[model samples]
Target chain A: MKLETRRVTKRYGDFLALDGASFQTGKDARVVALLGPSGGGKSTLLRVLGGLLLPESGEVVVNDQPLPQEPNEALKTLRKNGFVFQGYNLFPHLSALQNIVLPLCVVHGFSEPEAKERALELLKRLGLEEHFHKRPAELSGGQQQRAAIARALAPKPDLLLLDEPTSALDPVMTGEVLDVIRELAEGGQQIVLATHEISFARKVADWVVFLAKGRVEESCAAEQFFEQPNSALAREYLDGLSRYR
Target chain B: MNHPPTRRLLWSFALMAAVSLGLYITFAAVHYSWNWSSVWGYRSQFIWGWFTTLGISLGAMVVSIMVGFALMIGRRSTCMPLHLLSTGIVEVLRGSPLLVQLLLGYYIVATALHVGDPLVVGTVLLGCFEGAYLAEIFRGAVESIGASQREAARAVGFDTAQTYRYVIIPQAVRRALPGTTGQMVSLIKDSSLLSVIGIEELVQKVRIMNSSSYTALEGYLPLAVAYLVVTIPLSWYARKLERRFAYET
Candidate 1:
């Protein structure tokens, strides 16, 4: 599968969140990290790719079909994309198992038993089999992040979108979650993540896109970008981010 | 589990009883009848009237829920006019008194529309008035569910209708139950005001009995008991509903 954008732009009342931004992804992919400062439209770009927001101009084509003009149709295309939100937005009322099963049940028309069976498989793989009956409040930060990943993976989506998936976890917990993500990428899932984890991106990403002022300042192979970035903005971002590490 | 406050509670209860007896004696000396037999004789009419009141209130509540649902959807619709129109209608109903609305629906609307049925007029008044309050409850409930749930439903390929019916609405209804029940009880009490338009509800029946027998205390006291009979069970059921669909937050 291939996902690409052509001059995709989104503006929110005088604020240009994304300005003619473009990128592409193909199957059998490694991780792609969108590195940017806050309010630089990284989240906005993720939303555009996930079909959650419509561009004021330009277009997005997923697997070669231009996204439909109608909001509902575009949203249908979004079903194939998986998103992991920052803060791990798990349903508070639902048990861990219920949270994981929801996307599958909604998308695939899976029966209750069948959905649970699939949820249990993902839970077991994520080392959360024991936490299945617990609510999100009962889980630790690491556990909630894992559950969020389990939910994102449950539908077997073609494109995975993650927004700061490990922000809440400690270093040890972050490493644990990243390992699960790396394994998914190795298994051939195309993943796009917006994160502040520069070192993790250096280790796992194949493509690195540095964004500044709602436009792509630099896009390069991860090794090349980190080793010798072409843009002055990319250099400044790397230097500023390195201090926190 | 501790019964240590028993003495204090009893003293309060005794004090309340004395105040009540003093008031009753003062009123009785002013020729309020102690006519127990009159209450017993007209008991069936009172019972029938009480049932009519329940019927009207429940009918109005059902209608209110339907109108409320429509207004809820309208408020969320894409058309700006529909949204504004419903919002204005809700405001008009909520801002005005139910008694005033009852009179208008019965007198002005009924006359202008040339409808003779008091029942129709009363029901329309009760439903439209109560529906405004309920619309806010329903809207608040729908909004209370997290935005992520709607996004999740959409991402899973459910259409807008399915998103509401299968995912958003059930969760919203669960959250909205307590407020909905409270609105319903308020509707029941407000049904009494319809008696002003000669609707022959429980309060109306008590007024007629008191006028005929001149046993104001015996007649109206039983009506208070009757209203309590309906409201108490309803209040209890509302509490049970709150517990059953408890939101921890």
Candidate 2:
């Protein structure tokens, strides 16, 4: 549960996407909410953590082992990490159950019977038992989000990375999906979410990392960060977030 | 024998047929002498020649298709040297005409290397020539698949090779099927050029028959019929392939 980044940086051609951003989270700090608006490097940071993108210069260490840049090595470590993208990038060709079960079968080499049983159990827990056989196209947006979460949880990874997990949902749908995330946190899972819902952050997050313009604006305990943020930007942002709500 | 309008239509058709036959007879009798006996005799030879050409084209098409798929995958591979090599090969083959490739295969490779078997040499040449064109078709189709699919595969822990194998190639092959079929028809037509390499295809056989029989029109007309007989089925099969690969698109 020791996740640390030492001056992680990324540049796409000439554009500096992330510049000297760094953070640390120990086992005690379970939920780290990366709160930022779009294009503020939150997704970039999530990608670097998932090892999907190799930063131009940085060190990402999980449980004391350095993450490698090679795709195979990164994939080996990434299998132990679950990422929920904003678009819920599920394989369209696979059924909901298959999408969930694929990680266990392919990465862990689980037998068909065991994989199917585990997949069904996760789907049932996610309240998607009836849509197991349906493809992503056949499901509603909320159901697709649930299936994406189910997939993320299939391998029972040590880290769960969510990028705007509930941003695309309606209020009612958002509540239904956030409840599942709440249950996951309650069940002692390590969750890191990049979310816009300040109230949800207040309720569920153990720590908040506010980022602005590719740098960390503030990092503090959830209550302290919400109540009296150190950075003026975070204070103004919270005020604006409340006003918009 | 029938009602007025029906009988009139039938009489008209019969009259047209009679006039057409009379015209054909008059033209042939005046210019080209009747040769029913020779036509009856060389029926087996014509059948044999047509089958030989069909068989050769079929073989060439299969070899070229396999080569084309390999080129497509090879060119798209992350290895830079392989990609460059495949690109060079495709450029060289496609830049030259198929007839030149056939002749080169017959003279340069076959004689210089002492391969000696023209039939094998001819088919290989046809395959190599057609493969270059098909490679472009396949590469374009494979690259056209959305980048999201590749990202999803990587997220699920599939290696690059596995992503191409499971996700990219299946979709690309389906997308490229129509282009491939068109290439196949062109390849079959291009196989006709192999006659220049002393391969006794239908056209070449017709040349031989014309030389011996001194009936250029008579000998070549049936050869044209033979070519049509082979091509008609192939065009039908191409249509069938388009329908078959239209599933997911």
Candidate 3:
């Protein structure tokens, strides 16, 4: 599948979160990492890709069909992909198992037993079998994030958008969540992730898109971009990140 | 032999008993003829009145909740006109006095609709009044949920209705429970207002006994006790419910 965004611009009131950003990715780029500083349009671009936010202007075409203008049609097109948020945003009232089962049954029209079976399989696959009945509040941060990923994968969407899935976690917990994501990447799931973990991006992403001040500073193969950044801002960002490490 | 805290507790209990005895002595010194038989003679009327009050409260509670749910949705709807319309209705219902609404319902609305049943009119009027408050409670509860939850639901491919039914409303309902229980208790007390329209609820029966027996104290004392019987347990149940749903959150 190919996804292309042409001159997309999104504004929150007077502030422009995405300013005339444009890029394209083909099936070969299985894992694309949006690497940038905070508030540099990475999250905004990912949200736009996931149809969580509507751009004020521009076109997003997936598989040659433009994202529909109507809300309902846009939602239908968006449902072909899954999104994992940084906060894990699980339904706090529901058990971990029900979190995955509900969307399957309610949105995807799976029967009770069918939804339960799928949910159980995904939870176990994510190594959350013991915490299936625990609510989001009852589970630790790493477990919650894994459960969030499991919920996202339960539907087997064509694409996955992850917005800083490990940013809220500690280093150890971050590694745990990243391991799950790494496994998914190895399994050849088409994914886009917004993250500040430069090392994880270099290790897992095939392509890197460096954004600065809501504009794309550079987009290149991960290794090439890391070895020799195309923009001064990208160089400075990498330098600052390496110094912190 | 006793601990200091236990001795203090005994002293406090003795003081409370002394206060009660002094109050009783003061009442006895008043020399007013006590007409216990007059109030007791209408025991059947009071019981019937109690049930009628309960029935009206329950009926209004159900209708108000349904109407309140609709109003909450409308107020939060994407359509500007629907939101404005629901907001206006809620404000109007809540701004005006319940007494005025009842009078209007009994005189103008019921007559205009050609419905003469006092019970039905009373229920509708009280329901509408309480529904406005309930709508606000529901709105607060729904809005308190973080935006990420809605995003996650939509990300999972659920539409607006499904999001509310499965994700949003369940959490909102849990948060709204304490507030809702308070409104329900108020609703029971507010049903006493229906007596003004000749519904013959408990308060109205008490008023009748007062007029007939000319013993206001005896007539109203039992009425107060009857209301306590309903509200005390209801408030306790609300507390129980709050505890029951207070899961790890």
Candidate 4:
């Protein structure tokens, strides 16, 4: 799907989270990684794109349909996309299977048997068949994140938005979750993820947008942006990040 | 199973038995013209009174929970008028004493509305009183759930109502259970306060027996035991529910 934003600005009181941020993705770029500093507009832009957060001003259009300002209408539009939060946010009271089955049956209007079949399939695909009966509290961090991904993908959403999918995990757990995401990228799912892992972005992201202080510093192909960044801010940010790696 | 605190357990049992024996000896020595048979003769009246108390308590409990649910929704609503109205009601009901509210319900409301049934008036007034407190419990329970849970529900395509039905309320109810159970025990005890307004509950029946038989100890002790029978089990059940719903994260 073609996604574009025009001068989108979002503010929380005095702090501007996204200030006149504008960019467009080529139709071929299926996995777009939003690489930025912590307080930058990467998450804000991803939320705006997924219709999770309404921008204070300007436009976010996915396939030419402008995101609505009204909550009900916006929710209707957001139903077309899946969002995986940084915290995983799986239902603690629900088993892994029910987490997927509930959305499929309740929101998407699937029959009980049909929803169960779909949930079982996704759990099996995500290598969580043994954990189908476990609640989120019983699962490890990696298993919970995979269950969250399974819940998001159960409805077959057109677009997926992931906000720092691995920020809460350890290094080994991070690799496990990232591998699932990499597989989804290979499967041609349109995803926009806010991430600090530069190497993982280089491996999977087709397009990269580097943002800092609520503005896009650079937007280019992943190879081009990493190899020869156009702006000084992008170069400095990459340099600072590389030291930590 | 491992050591079992046997000495502590035996000490507690011995102490309880000694206390019971001392209390029984004191009772035997009182000699206040004890007339147990007079109180015992009015067994049917006491039973009817017990049934009335149970009925009112159960009825008021149901109404309070329903009203509490509505008040909770209204309090959390974005609409200013709804929020203000619910807040005002909760404050008014919770701010005043139940006795005054019962008096007002019987004297002003019952007379003004020309309602003759004292039991109905007492039940409704008591319900409103309990509802305000239950509303706070509901609010706290709902707020205790993290905001991310709601966001996750929304991301999964649930609308506001569906989110509450399938996700938010289910978890909130489990969290609220222990608190609600405590309130219910209090409600049963509070139902005795309805006696002043002329509802023939357990305490009122005890008062009648005291006046007729002139035996206060014989009349009041059984009343306290009856309340214990109701409340102790309720508290035990609340503890059970707390353990049952405790999700080990």
Candidate 5:
């Protein structure tokens, strides 16, 4: 999951979410952690990578090819990549199985039987097999988030971009989601995650990109960035978080 | 939470008694001569008119919903001309009075198109009038769905059409149910306005009966009850739908 962004800029009204932000990840880095405080550019950057938001300006090169300027073309290029949002935006009208099956059949062009088969397999893998027939409102928060993860993974995406996936969960629910994410990361699934869970990032992230105020404060291997300080911003950020524990 | 079935039944009976008492007092207060025999003589004519009103209202509802859905799609469409055209049509229809629309529509527009049947023209015009209002109701329902739902669909690689189809419209349709039914009720009441075109709906028949018998309450009172017969069940059904959808929420 190699990525190189050149002076990417995105704005929301009067606020700049990405202010000439140039970010890069090392080659073959499967688990890249985008760590930032709330109101920073982490979610926006993840959204841009997921092709859900087109940049206001600048270039995003993924795997040596530039991202497409045309909106449909861009989504086409990254169709293999999945995204999990802060809120588990499952289709409330659909049961867990249907939520996953809909995308498989409608978007991925899977036949109904094949889509159901794939959806059931994914639900079982996510420990939600017993709750497949339940709508999102019927499931607990942790279970719904897991269902959302299964929906994302059903497409067999090469890259999974998660934006604050645990931001809306309780501590226990967050742990449940993180453990599943860890298992996926360990299983060699490529993931680019923007999160606030420092310890989890330390455990699983191969590459680290610390952002604050819409700019990259630190970009390096996770090990060296944690052990030895690269910049004052990174050191302060890390120190403040460690002080909490 | 719901009241126990027995409690609900008791409350309904009590409320019905109160309404019936109020009606009894109101009618007793009026000095119009009691003419139950004359009202009975016109029962067959009134029944035919009631059926006519029922058919017209139901047909108009069907046409209105179709027009409403089409306008909603057009207003949200990517094509510039379609969006503008739908917006313009909705504004024009909703801004004018229904009475004027029936008059002008039948006299000029229907005549221009050589659509001479007053009943058909009136029903269609009533539908288009209510359709403009229904279009906005449908639009509000669609917008009530959060933006994240669409993004989630896209993340799964659902295209624009697929997003609306598999994810959006299903939920919107449910949310639209209550408001849609409310519009239907309004349309049913508004069908009385079609009396000006001599369609012989319930109100038109009652008006003629009143003039002939020189009695107001005899014909009009039963007409009101006849309307309640159609509309009360519809209101009850709408609430049922709202409850069923509420479970999802």
Candidate 6:
């Protein structure tokens, strides 16, 4: 997946969330991680990439095509991408299997049997087959997040955009979710994620984009960016993250 | 919270005993002697009236829910005229007295429109009165759903109607159950007001018996019990529905 943003600017009242943010994924980078501190515009940029949020101004180009301004026309782009939110945001009323099947059958117009087969496949792949009939309230944080990921993946979207997918989990559960993401990355799935899991990003991310104060500070291959961050802001950001470790 | 069945039964017996004692004391305190002979003559009337009340209440309940849903949709519509019109009508129905609406509907509007059946007009007017309140309840339930739910639906490519039908409404209906149950009980009791428009319901039958028997208490007591008979079962059904819709927690 070729993901690119050009001069994207977004504001929420007085807070500038994304200010002229621009970056392009390497043609072969299967997993691109947006690395930044809290409220550093990483999530906003990821949302724009996922077609979940439209920037107030500027272009979000994915695979060399910019998203249309009007929402109706942009549905094509939105449909091609799947998003996993920070909170996991699974429908509380639906079972784990249903969480995946409903959108496939309802929105994408898949037959029930076909959607069910697809949902069951993903659940088994995510190691959630036993929890197929359980509602979100009955599942652990990691299980719920995995179910949400399955829901996003069921439609076979070209790009998967995840926003802090493990933010609500414990260290143990975070590892559980991260392992699944790593597997997806290794399987050649295209993913753009905004995440705080620094070491995990270093391990799985093919490309890295460092953001701070609502602007991109650096963008490069993951290993180089993690080992020798060029920008002073990027260096300090990495230094601050390493303090606790 | 986990009382043993024997203990629960004991508590139930105690409550019944208490209520029975209160009733006994009240009857003893009254000056007039009890006379079942006169009231017994109207057994068939009571039976007829009881069933009539049930039919009217069920009819009105259906109307109220349909009208309420339509109004809720209208109020939530993006079209300016529809939103304003639904808002204005909801306000009017909620603000004014039900008796006034029934009178106007039966005496004026129904007459002018050649809607001669007072029963139909009364049921509709009474339903509209409750429908306004129900519309607000439905709206509140839909609004109480977290924004994230809508976002989740949208992220999966749901359009406006599909979102409501597949995601929003199923959850909203669960949240709205308790409020709707209360409204239904109120609707059953409120159906007695339909007697004013010559519906010949339970309350109307009781009024007729009281006019001759001159025993208001005797006439009204049975009416109250009949209403309770309808509502107790209704409340039980609501609880069952609540359990069915409740998310596992």
lDDT of 3 by residue, B94-180 (tens): 999999999998999899989999999999899989999999999999999888889888888888888888888888888999899
Residue B37 in candidate 1, Cα distance off native in Å: 3.3
The local lDDT score (0 to 100) that residue A70 gets in candidate 5 is 96
Candidate 1 deviant stretches above 4 angstroms: A1-3, A24-28, A62-65, B1-33, B107-117
* Shift in Å, residue B223, candidate 1: 2.2
The lDDT of model 4 is 0.90
Per-residue CA lDDT of candidate 1, range A118-232, in tens? 9999999999999999988888888888898898888888788888888878988898888988888778888888988998888878887788889888777788989999999
| Per-residue lDDT of B201 in model 3 | 98
lDDT of 2 by residue, B1-249 (tens): 436998899988999999989979888787867565665566677777788788888888888988888898779878999999999999999998877877877888789988998888988888888988998998999899888678767766778777777667766777788788788878777777888888888777777776676666778767766777767787788777666644322
lDDT at A80, model 5: 80
The window of 10 residues in a row where model 5 chain B has the poorest summed lDDT is: B240-249
Q: What is candidate 6's local distance difference test score?
A: 0.90
Give fnat, all candidates: 0.35, 0.35, 0.82, 0.82, 0.78, 0.75
- Candidate 3 regions exceeding 4 Å error are B1-33
Off by over 4 Å in 5: B29-32, B77-84
- At residue B80, candidate 1 shows an lDDT of 97
CA shift at A74, candidate 1, in angstroms?
A: 1.1
lDDT of 6 by residue, B1-249 (tens): 669999999999999999999989988898667777788888899889999888888888999999999999899989999999999999999999899889888999999999998778887887899999999999999998888999988898887788898889999999999999999999999998998888999999988887887667788888889999989998999999988998953
Model 4 per-residue lDDT tens digits across residues A103-165 = 899888999999999999989988999999999999999999999999999999999899999
Question: How well does model 1 score by local distance difference test?
Answer: 0.83
Q: Taking the tens digit of each residue's C-alpha lDDT, what string does model 3 give over A1-245?
A: 56678888999889899998887765478899999889999999998887877888998877677887678888887787889999999989899999999888887889989999998999989899999999999999999999999998988988899999998999899999999999999999999999999999999998888888888888888899999998999999999999968
TM-score of chain B of each: 0.84, 0.80, 0.88, 0.89, 0.94, 0.96
lDDT of each: 0.83, 0.82, 0.89, 0.90, 0.89, 0.90
Name model 2 segments beyond 4 Å from true.
A167-176, B1-40, B206-249
Which interface RMSD values do the candidates have, in the order shown? Answer: 2.7, 2.7, 1.2, 1.1, 1.4, 1.6
